[model samples]
Target: MSTVADNTTVTEAPVADLTNVLARGPRPKRPSAWSASVTFGWRAVLKIKHVPEQLFDVTAFPIIMVLLFTYLFGGALAGSPREYIQFLLPGIMVTSVVMITMYTGVGVNTDIEKGVFDRFRTLPVWRPAALVGAIFGDMLRYAIASLVILGIGLALGFRPAGGVLGVAAGIALLILFSFAFSWIWTMFGLLLRSEKSVMGVSMLVIFPLTFLSNVYVQPSTMPDVLEAFVQANPVTRLVTAVRTLMDGGWNTGEVLWVVVASAVLVAVFGTLTMRLYNRR
Candidate 1:
């Protein structure tokens, strides 16, 4: 049907025409990858705001670990609790970052369970923005862990012979390692069925690397086989590098190894994570 009013002519289209027109309507422009990633990162950080308790593991765990090791085993391990703290802080910092990285997987798995990832997948932004943004948010957790451990250790008569710059460099390295390590958990988050499973598996991996390495004790004290594993363990390298840096030593060999290991980890796990994410 058609009607004429003033100088305008109006025509009624078929119902299907209106439906088809709407189907072809323009949508909002998609954001750039960086912008999208920042937006997503903000959202990921917001998760902590809503659930403040989620930060307990990062903030409190470092304190507990530092205090426990310093008080309980410090005397036996390093001749005195005070002396042991000097040797233990760097190792504990590395272990703290390693343990906290698992929470990244846990958070991602929780999002998967809640269909948040599905919603993200439907967005017009870059596909990897969700994971990247979450990683950015996770860096804050790493910072908190490192700072708390260092601060508490300082209060407990632990002094870094490397001074401020050394401590800063060591912390920077640890954070870099944590970022690289988180990719492994990111892949597991994408592949695993549940958060609990990821946590269990991650802890299993963490325990051996941390306990078997020169964290609480020197590798020289261990059996040959155990010492061999510790020598090759990346965690050992990281701990040694941090200790060297914080102790004012310029030995770049262990630090180089940590860098290489972190780079390799980022390359392998990052690729795997992206592949699994796309498949999902």
Candidate 2:
């Protein structure tokens, strides 16, 4: 009886130890945040590599817009093709930057839905910042797209009156605005479930915002009702501010407001997205 009891106790001890080990769970691994961010960036680059055609619009659309607008509406709009191209180029560039920001949300939603991000969560890292860094790194592609469009604009005889420094400054401001806009979309992507729905939701807000601004035409030419909206629109202010800077015009208020507004947006959306990411 004593020998049977000892054997049973020995068996029970190993079983209890095994149960405790299983209950304690696997040890969490520590991952470097910067390394994770770089990994996310590489993932983005790989995606871009596979879908090279994804960038067609950025590469081809500018030329098409310049051709169509310069040929079709130039006479009625600006009296000549050259004049129309000059006027339309800035608006097209700004609009393209704004439109490109939409991809940040779409990319995020796609990653989340496709289990790419789920895999990411299994790794120990500053997960939220890793996502943000990925989105920001992708913005570099958008910036390059903008630069390519601008280069084409120059080839089409669209000159900035503000010289090289002014052109650089304009590009800088546009890039900053794009980076800020990306955060809002990132938040949306993190909070949303479906990738396809992101565009619908974003456009529902962005289209009117871009159209109501001084994007395709001067605000003064718009009807009073429309003009009022354009005058007050943040996008309008940003475009005008960039134009003013390029044209060497005085508009300190516009510049100040754009910077302040962009900063506020980055802070608000970035914080909200981080919180939402943690919850996820």
RMSD of each: 4.3, 5.6
lDDT of each candidate versus the true structure: 0.89, 0.79
Per-residue CA lDDT of model 1 for 167-267, tens digit only, reads 99999999999999999898888889999999999999988988889999999989999899999998999999999999999678988888888899989
Candidate 1 global CA lDDT score: 0.89
Best by TM-score: 1
Segments of candidate 1 deviating more than 4 angstroms: 1-29
Q: Candidate 2 residues 1-280, lDDT tens each? A: 9999999999999999898878576876666777677777787777778998877766787567667767788788889877887777667778777877888899889878888888877766777755767775777777777788778878877888888777777777888888888888888898777876888889888888887888777888989998999998888888887777676564789888888888999899988988888898
Collision count for each candidate, in order? 0, 0
Residue pairs with backbone atoms closer than 3 Å in model 1 (clashes): none
